[model samples]
Target chain A: MSTTATLPGGPGRQSGQDILNLVLTVGLLPVLMAIVIIGTSLMSPYFLGWMNVVNILRMASFLAIIACGQAMVIIAGGFDLSVGAVVALASVVTAKAMAAAASAIGGPDILAIVIGIAAGLGSGLAVGLFNGLCVARLKVSGFVVTLGTMSATAGIGLLLTNGIPVYGMPKGFVQAIGRSQILGFPLAIYIALAVVLAMAFVQRRTLFGRYVYAIGGNQEAAVVSGVSIRRHLVGTYVLSGGLAATVGILLTALVGSGQASLGGDAMMLQSIAAAVIGGVSLRGGIGRVEVVAVAALFLTILGNALNLLHIDSRLQPIFLGLIMVLAVALDEFSRRRMSRV
Target chain B: MSDADLAAPAKPAAIDARGSRILQGTGWARQLALPIALVLLLAGFGLADDRVLTTYNLLNIAQQTSYLALFAMAQMVVILTRGFDLSLGPTVSMVSVAAALAMAGIGGADANGIVAVLAAIAAGFALAAACGLFNGVVVSILGVSPLVATLGSMNIAIGVATTISDGRPVQGVPAAFADLFYRGSILGLPIAIVIAILVGGVLAFVLSRTVFGRSLYIIGTNPQAAAVAGIPVKRLLVYAYVLCSALAALGALMMTARTGSGEPNLGGTLSLQSIAAAVVGGTSLAGGRGGVGSAALGALFITILSNGMNLTRIDGYVQMIVLGAIVILGVVLDRLRLDGR
Candidate 1:
């Protein structure tokens, strides 16, 4: 079994202070968001408009939902590069299911949605389990294992569709899930919020959540304490995969079609960025679902503000990339400073 | 003499230690399970399609493998040092464009074109080195995890490449330059393939023979131990990253010359595929082990897979799925070997 590699100080003395620091560090995301809001509102009237704000929220919702699972994986000291690929594959599966349901069940709206969600979650669960088996049983690095899964899942998507886009998804389905607003708020936004809250509850109140933190903090310690490393690791990835699938389903609903190539290739990076920006340690064992949700929303707002300001669309990637780098750089600096003390 | 004193003979101690060393050395072969699987796949494909082994198809595979082989070597070095350079793909694309533009700037003479190409190489080295330096400084000195640091760099590199080209392809390199890459051959083999072999060979030698190379393995295996032992851990890591990016630039040059144009998307799959090749070839993501030569072979295997799949008229999209599956299988097998250890 691996032992905790101590660095001068033990965990007991610093754990309380570390928790306080994490709280303050994670709070920075929401603070930044407030600044962005005030600045954007001051700069452009359109920025403050309810419509634009709602649009940003809706966009952030998709990413936030996915990041919820991502947070869990990071907490477990693992990564899921296959999330984007899973989304792509899940979207295709959902579309195919919807079409079949429509033909057999007289417009398979509800049934199709249910089946699509289940299929997406199931695929994700399988992939997660596979990744877990590799990492826990086989001892492969999470980074490489998930990366392999990423490529294979993407291949599955292509093979299933022959690279063709699946179109003519039911419009009603799209409206209800993707575009419909209840009480002046987008359904997707509400869904994202609900997911975030649920994740927060799980992370704070559940034994499994505590196990995730323990594993990330020190795998050896967790194992010695009798935590089922394999089961928990698999569960974390399964949650991540399932969330990714949910995002895919939402994306399909929004677009009313499924394209094998539609999901973001940059998603893995973006999810990591959001988590880091929200103060999730890449070293693992620390982070909050709420922080990631805020970070995702902040990024969406930044993108929206840039778009409204007539910035070229192509530059968006560059700016976001810069932000990601800076975020990590800042995190590193802070971590070192904290550790030094 | 006491029974304990007689039982523990000093003479046999050295023999036992040497035996363990030999056992550890041979341990590398167990890592070859993935590469062996890849070979089986190639054999399977060769039997399924006669065209897979045709000289023309084989040559095609070699040419394609050359590009990724360079990439795999680059990735291997970085991974060996326990870091990654996600900016590699974009760095390659950018270098490719710079080389083509440099050629155009130098007019049409072969000598001048060659000079331009070297200058482009220098530029690529310089640029990639800077990115690597940034990552190294942030990760090693600032204490950021490799995943976050490199993920950010990947985005920035891609953005920089696209921005430099204004999202347009750069075409019309000097005819001689293109001819050198596209037409030059030795004994019916492409010059690019020859260069790739040389690069792979030299890198393998460096990894095995050089102090800097040995240091990389030590640092990767245990950074704290390496640092405590007085190794310049940060500097070595930075150099590894620089070497990785510089090689990626070389790949870009070859790709640009082959296409006679610079496309922003040239290295889109390079990062993932190169990493896959390295993993499949027995490079441990956990660090401290692997060879560039194995990575070269892994790249060749991937190239063969692509070529054979093409010959069979498997849709390009489906091929992606297969590639992904291969990557996952590679990692899984690698994990199994590690677990055995």
Candidate 2:
């Protein structure tokens, strides 16, 4: 872990230690994924099979999309506890809309699919808008705003679902979102890749992204530089909400039902973990979406490896928790060292 | 480092808040809001159902408030220090399950059951200590932020608990144990209520009177200042996290008694709910500005809201929305008060 990337001399005249820290922070996950892959393949014959690889990618896609959204909020120096709830609520709304549309039209129809997707995305956007307004306009803490939304979203989800799963979506929606394959890959995986790529571009190349980073890095500096902190923050939050809703809608299509519990606590926590592990700084103004998506992939691979190794599903969380702590601590330590330099 | 450095910024802010308190009216209104809202809530509930104000129901509210009061304080301890334990809910679940599992494993109802109960509580505390120590070390010694550290540990705790309980409720608790501890009264007050009061008194006294508590606030407010003042910032932070985990375990113990079983799912909502209570009671998430009294008030507020809503026959789903709304309201008012100052 302490070894450098062996290309220490950069244009900025960085040292070997700086290169080492960079490798430790950014490259550790890929290394871990490789190690897990090798270890699991040795332990189980089927671990590295094509079907298993595809399965892992499919599972990873959901979390990747979520991490993409969460990274934006975090980069803006905000938190969103409501992502899981948003997922649940959006899922319920999407499923319900699809079911209603199908029934009203007296058959399976493309309109139902359109209505469901639109409803899911809309709800997510609405939550994002609300969170953004509260944080930026109302001047409430982002933590508080998101916490309230998380609870309310869950409640609304439950109210809609009545503690029962809402089923009967248009078949086309599920087939398209869940099972559609291009070059032997699920459509959801492609969607996740697109989201990850788009988010990465936004974070790296866009003016809005630069403004978000500036605001999060130092609000006073950003303000002095003529950035509108309020507007940027609102935009980041709204984007976060909208992205989470996308996942909710996708999950609904995949499951062919809407469940208030669809976005479990694990999903929320894991998304945050994936973001942090992917090198996104919790304090803001750091991290890349492409990296975060890979981190999510790393997590999925790790989970799959654990299953192949026959680790009890229940014990996996303990490992995950420990790994998350280690990852964040590693990130913190490297950041400290880099700052001192 | 001079006295003026501390007193300079502190005095004017104090004066400003005081000035606003006397003039702006919103300053005072925010302070009065909790009690006022509480009174109105009770009155409305009482009006809707004459039985809501009866002695039995009032006492019932007190009894119901006990565990939540503990939970709020548990969260408040860390919140006072500019950190929070997202792992608390899982801590509750783990402790409850651990205690119940220990007692159930022992199988004997004899020997005054004190030994068995003591052993069970010890098991719970041991688990609590692990969680606290892990969080403290990861956050304080390793320099990770509380959010990442606790979020990771939360997953681990959840996994450990669910695994231990086989993802099912553990119900072999001695009938006598639950009956005596959960239902038995001391001096006409429910034992749980008595314990809550005693703990609240102790925590309050500690926060107001002890060097440890004072240092915690200082560290939370500004670590550099705390270090300059010769406080053991790292060690105390660890202690604060430990204290948080232990108190959360105590709440879990109470919950276990109330439920008469060990439940892995018991604390799924506790983390957010306790946070909601603490903030509502006047605790700031920014830290260094709340106490046990505030925690008590917050817990009381939550309990009243829930109980009153029940009395009014509002659906549970709507109660969740109201709870979310109240949490947001609390933070908004806090923000306004700060701005006014």
Candidate 3:
């Protein structure tokens, strides 16, 4: 377990460690999925159908999009409880914008889609900025600050529409974005995959990514080394917000309506769980985007398998919770083992 | 020139002393601020709304606050030792639901309600204590970070709670137990309030006057130093978690009594609010500070905020926003005090 006893500089290079960790983390997801597939196939002949696989991918897409941002935030040494709320806000804002646009301009689908994306990004940035200010300037703990933002955003969403679900999106907009597919795959899944790949690239190749890891590894050291800790911190949160908004929009497209209350709540816990399960250290400074993406898939598959097994929907969260704890416990144990050796 | 230089030197000394005095005063005030705020807020609300001052309303507030106060104190104890109990809320819910179910099975009101209640409380404490122990073992012995360890436990606890309740609220609490909450007022004060006050006072004594309490502060300030000084760091951490859970169990009892039912989501708000109250009362998340008196006061302040909003007929969503703002404000004030230190 101890890396120290190995030949000096033998196996500790950045690429080697990254590859090893990535393989281990990403490999687990497929193994879990295969197991689920096999088990479910034995129980029901329709388990391995292409449609079922597509269904799983579609469900995983929205959560995976959100998890990408969450992975970054955790790696940057902060948590964002308000991502869910941001999603809800974004969804509602987009719905209203689309409705208004359709009424005024006879339904320009492209314009409405662009407007939705812009709204999602703007709303996310606003909340992220508020959170960053409170955390950095006011020097509040990230946990408390984010929690406040979470509540406030939820309130904002409720107030905007009096807690009613917003409907009547442009029909063309829904058809093009929500139900459209390319090469037998959902557009949302492809979008999520692209985002995940981009995140992975940023984490591996960008100076900004290095800065994030440096700050998470040691704040004072990063500051002394001339990193703009405040700017980068705020940027990370803004990015998280934007990604959450994207997830929200995708969810709206899938459902063909905007229901603020339900959409955001589950994402908060799920994103966090997925990040942790993927080997992201809650203490920050270590994690991989690919791992988190895999984790999102693992969770989705598990839920899908359980549903197929006729397990109660209510018990799903409980099972997910248990798995989350187990993952962290294992991570903790491995970390300790590595440190001791 | 010699006289002026001498006077300037004296001025610097005077300023230094005054600065130190201010720091000390802020520390002292910070400790008492939450309690003072609680009292003042209650009084202000009582004045603004005549009904707020009435015995009925006051008792009602007390009853509502007791459950939160218990959870807050539990959170305070763990945080004082530089740990967290994310599982506290779920533990309470799980125990309350189990108790309610047990009572329902035991012929409603007359089927040995006392034993069933005690058993439920014990089960809650035992479960919470075990979680704390798991966290302690991982954190203190295995060198896992508290944030990661507890986040994992939070998920597991939530899962267990959900599984136990099967996603349904447990109704049909024993009549006698319900009456103890709804009808058992003494001298116009709710019995629950008396229980909370008693719990607060007793815990206050234990925390302030006992050797174990002092040791917890030592552990919180510097775990390595405490371990070196033979403070039994692992044991104390476990103890802190156990006490936190036990108190949460007591809170569960009161909550069950008051609501006359137990829901899986019973303690959702309590988790964050308890931490908020503890922090507002000057219990630093960094650990090694604060007392139960301030925590109780913090709880009272929160209650006042909610109750006042209710009386004013403030929009529920706006009230949530206000509460979030208050939390941020409290954290900001705390940060300022810490920076001065």
Candidate 4:
């Protein structure tokens, strides 16, 4: 089997429909982002400021991180819906761990933070392991498995904290993560950028990446062709879990505490929306990490702009819904065009 | 005839006659699993708490499961066609808010109460059906995955709900409205329970007897085959979604009545809960199997689980964990049964 089966309309003889498909698939998101930026800047002076731009990137950092993991899972023919809960669980665990470590060890800060972070991430991985085992080994649909995990994880988070926020991490640690800057930008931005780049490299250059695409493209074919489908599928979910945990840790720093509902309903939905808007196909087998990063930025900027515009936060889902539908419709339009040929 | 058989590759069995007999029995086993589980749970809970199996509690369970039963049936309709309505919760929310608004605004004490209730219900159902129409067009005509498409619809519905109600419950509905629609009984049973049974009975009849319902099975099992067989796949898909959303709306009406107001924030756990109920009842996520009766039983199982836990003084968080575990266990058992066959 071919290692990289090209998507439809692979630079062959040109047709109008093919051109449209290519543009819709590849060019629409960036164009949409630029339009939003320019349009919003014209409406509000603060929208175009460097500070606001950096803030938008900073605001999107957590979502971008989660979306990167979600992108990998989607590319591998499964997706995680428990990410938002995982983030909350991770946050709570991290905060609790940090507090316990600080109290026990008298905080040189770094040691306590390190241990705390590990504990938080460990919790996340545990959740992922359960999801991965059920989805990959048991052959359960990822949707149902993750749906169950989401509720369970959220319940676990709430149980641990008694529905309250954990507080009092080391001030130094919080400052470093939440407010420390590199030159003019937040550390969160740099971290998100690093994640995006690393994921892009892994997606484009690694054998596991190739396996993911192959499995998503055709699971039976991938299995027949010597791919370790179960292992890779589980790995994708683990990656998602770990990344969501990382986001949880970041959220702890940013808020200076951990709450059971850290990311809330909108967070998971936003990550998925970002992935979809950036041209990640829900059916799997096709996506780029770089595009997903852009998609996350697009969503963040849209939300920020709307905030600046004084739009009701409650109405935000409507715009998100409309954009999501439009994006999928574009995907459909492109697929139809390719199939017609 | 079944999705599993259609999707299963031709592999020789490695089992003996006894094993084959067990495998042959798996089909009906899967059908009976949820009901049997429900019975075992009821017995267990009854043994634990005398109040758990009392007539009052039984009636309470029926009343509580009524809305969930409606939601499960809605999900089952689309699941039967290999589609999902993630928007069902939001649709319910929107319908509830709309119904509440109508009841509060249009159905004053001076107004004709019956006519006002009828008009409000008509409007509520119309909005819900429209939501389904949008989802259907996106999934069928546009060919988007049901997950992404309905997720978008969910966002839109939520937005509408929040906007219309301004994030508050529409209150002061006529007391008689709540009495008739929510608390009032027909033949010594809650009207909500009566409505739920009627809906389930009608759906069960239609699913088994109607061409439209049978077409869902064919389409879900293998869309390509159905298309080749000249089913109007796209139109039928639309109809399925519309039906699903309409049923959700009906559930929303019950919810609104029960609350004695239209609550914009309703449906927090509903979408997942409905899916959980459906899956637990033995409905296939892969589609082309299961029925309304099974889904209703699933809803009953879930409601009883919650109610029993409450009676046993289980923490709400623990209940959440158990509910999540049950969904995963249900799917795991389902997979094992399918693999056995």
**Cα lDDT of model 4 by residue, B238-292, tens digit:** 9999999999988888888888888887877788899998888778888876787
Q: Which candidate is the best by lDDT?
A: 4
> DockQ for each of the predicted structures, in order?
0.59, 0.70, 0.47, 0.79
Write candidate 4's Cα lDDT for A156-186 as tens digits. 9999999999997998778999889999898
How big is the positional error of residue B68 in model 2, measured in Å on the Cα after superposition?
Answer: 0.6
Deviation from native of the Cα of residue A265 in model 3, angstroms: 2.9
Count the clashes in each prediction.
Answer: 4, 0, 1, 0
**What CAPRI grade goes to candidate 2?**
medium
lDDT (Cα atoms) of all candidates against the true structure: 0.77, 0.85, 0.76, 0.86
Return the TM-scores of chain A for each candidate in numbered order. Answer: 0.88, 0.91, 0.89, 0.92
Model 1 Cα lDDT, one tens digit per residue, A130-240: 877777776667887788788778878888888788875666778888778899998888889889999999999999999999999999999999999999988898888
**Stretches of model 1 off by over 4 angstroms after superposition:** A1-28, A107-109, A168-171, B1-39, B108-115, B180-182, B186-188
lDDT of 1 by residue, B127-190 (tens): 7677777777766776777777777777777777787778888875776666666668888789
Q: What TM-score should be assigned to candidate 3?
A: 0.88
- Model 4, backbone clash pairs (residues 3+ apart or across chains), number: 0
Which is the leading candidate under TM-score?
4
List the lowest-lDDT window of 10 residues for candidate 2 chain A: A1-10
Against the true structure, candidate 3 has what lDDT?
0.76
* Residue clash pairs of candidate 2: none
What RMSD does model 4 have?
5.3
